[model samples]
Target: MTLDDLFSAAREAMAKTHSPYSKFPVGAAILTEDGRVFTGANIEVVSFPEGWCAETTALGHYVMGGGGRITDICVTAERLDECTPCGGCRQRLAEFAPPDARVHLTDQAGITKTITMVDLLPLGFKTEILST
Candidate 1:
């Protein structure tokens, strides 16, 4: 799918965010190399620091749908322009996507900047290191 399509999916997911506490709705869309798309929204729980980020939710859907090589990702926030993933989300994304995978940051108007997973987490721990 095109970046625009992915961004649109994220926006739709943002509308479904269950962030009653933070009031900061966020959305994420993942595009697998096989052309499958998965979307998710931020979910907040009563317990502080127990909430999940939009990217984490998207990764959950991607895993349940039979994980594949993630080629691209889109993230957007209802209140922030060009919202990027959080540090934790960056590590989570790096676990599934390659260093070169494109990360599209979007605003209400659509994608505003494109970055790579490596750019988001230059010193991220590689899953390969854990395999041994």
Candidate 2:
């Protein structure tokens, strides 16, 4: 799917965010190489550390659906400037998305920028590390 389409999915998922604590709703949409799309919204718990990021949730949904090889992912939030995935989420994405996979950042004004996952998380830890 196109980046715009993925952004739209992210927006839709954002509407379902259960962030009663922070009220900083976030959403993510992951497009697999096989053309499957999985959307997720941030879920927060009373304990801050227990909260799940939108990207991580989306990745989990994709895996649960038997999807693999993320080709692109879009993230959106009210504050566009802070919509980028966190360090933990970035590492989680690196587990599935290739270095060249597209990472799109979206906001109320629409997509802000599109960069490769490598640009976001250089020197990511991959399976090769475990094999070694």
Candidate 3:
């Protein structure tokens, strides 16, 4: 699928956000190397700081779908343009995505910037090191 298709899925996911406290809806879409797409939206609970990020949720779906190489990721926020993943999410994404994986930062109109996974998390902990 194209980047636009990914963005569209993310946008649709954003519309389903359950951000009652923050009211800041965010969406994420992951494009796997096998041509499958997974989408997720931020979900908040009554307990503060217990909510999951869009990227985290998307990663959950990716994992459940039998995880594979993630080629591209798209993220968008309803309140901000080119909203990026949080620090926690950067590390989480680094665990699955390769250094050269494309991360597309998008707004309502479309993608504003495209950065590599390494660029997004230069100092992220390597899974290989953790596993060894």
Q: What is the C-alpha lDDT of each candidate?
A: 0.94, 0.89, 0.95
Model 2, span 1-132: residue lDDT tens = 777788899999999999998889999999988899999999999998699999989998998999788889999997556479999999999988899999998768578889999999997777777987
Sorted on TM-score, best first, the list reads 3, 1, 2
TM-score of 3: 0.98
Per-residue error for 31 in candidate 3, Å, reads 0.1
TM-score of each: 0.97, 0.93, 0.98
> What is the per-residue lDDT of model 1 for residues 14-127, given as tens digits with 9 covering 90 to 100?
899999999999999999999999999999999966999999999999999999999999999989998889999999999999999999998799999999999989999899
In model 3, what is the error at residue 125, expressed in angstroms? 0.7
Candidate 1, residue 75: Cα displacement in angstroms equals 0.1
| Native RMSD of candidate 2 (Å) | 1.3
How well does candidate 2 score on lDDT at residue 2? Answer: 72
Which candidate achieves the best lDDT against the true structure? 3
